[model samples]
Target: MNIRLRSAVAGDYDAVNAIIREGQDEHAEALPDRFARLDQVVAMGWYRSFSKQPNKEIIVAECGDKLVGVAMLEMKQSPSFEALVPRTYAYLNELAVASTHQRQGIGKKLYTASLAWARERGASSLELNVWEFNERAQQFYASVGMRTLHRMLFTDLT
Candidate 1:
């Protein structure tokens, strides 16, 4: 199957939302307290707002006439502070491939496009956050040459 990667347009709202909702549903099921499944209206609205950010982009993977995957990216800079190094980077806010279309290299295409987009815009690095419960996602990311940067820990104070 041929997969085409391109910048998303306003007309892609529904398809993109559907793909995102799949991932959201999984997250919600795995961690009810941390993830909430969004309704279509709310998801679409949030996508609209997020896509409009000046330093953000939404990349979609299309198979023939269907949108099967999406990657949301954001350009960010490390804050100038005494304890931090200054640099610009690209953040992979979200990446989701439709349940029916996984393992066909669509995710890799989206990721390649995202990296190129960041490189073209002078970003020095690419980063993303994956929840521990999503082992599949972690494995996919690792297969693409990403490694653990840091771990976020939390305590239940109850």
Candidate 2:
């Protein structure tokens, strides 16, 4: 397929949201209910605010006029989880390619664009969370030189 990579615009939100919803469904099916609540959270407007944040960006890969992949980035000073926190970082909130487009390099292209955006802004590190069982994603991240830094655990308070 002929794919074009570009920065996202406000007009792209619907397509971006569709990709997110589909990705989240697959993600939810593989995880516990606690984390699955993200589908609802995103649907209720959380992700809508992401692109508006000063430090956040969303990129899309399009085949003709159709969006085939997306990557979302959040750049910020490293939070002081401890008093001795390190340098600035970019958080990769989401990176997804349409299931039909897997293995076509859309995800990688989107990731490359995101990394350039982060590096241009002086971020020292780029971080993201991938489910432990997502071996394909793990391999992709590893291929692009992302190392596992931490494991996130979730609990349901509801």
TM-score of each: 0.93, 0.84
Q: Tens digit of lDDT per residue, candidate 1, span 1-158?
A: 99988888889998988998899899999999988878672366667766788688999999999999999998999999989989999999889999999999999999999999899989999999999999999999999999999999999886
Which digits, one per residue and each the tens of the lDDT, describe model 2 over residues 48-128? Answer: 666667788878899987899999888877667788667888989899888878899888888888889899888988889
TM-score of 2: 0.84
- Per-candidate local distance difference test: 0.90, 0.80
Q: Which stretches in model 1 have alpha-carbon errors above 4 Å?
A: 41-46, 49-54
Number of the top-ranking candidate, with lDDT as the measure = 1
Error of 2 at 26 (Å): 1.6
State the lDDT at 117 in candidate 1.
88
Candidate 1 displacement at residue 1 in angstroms: 0.7
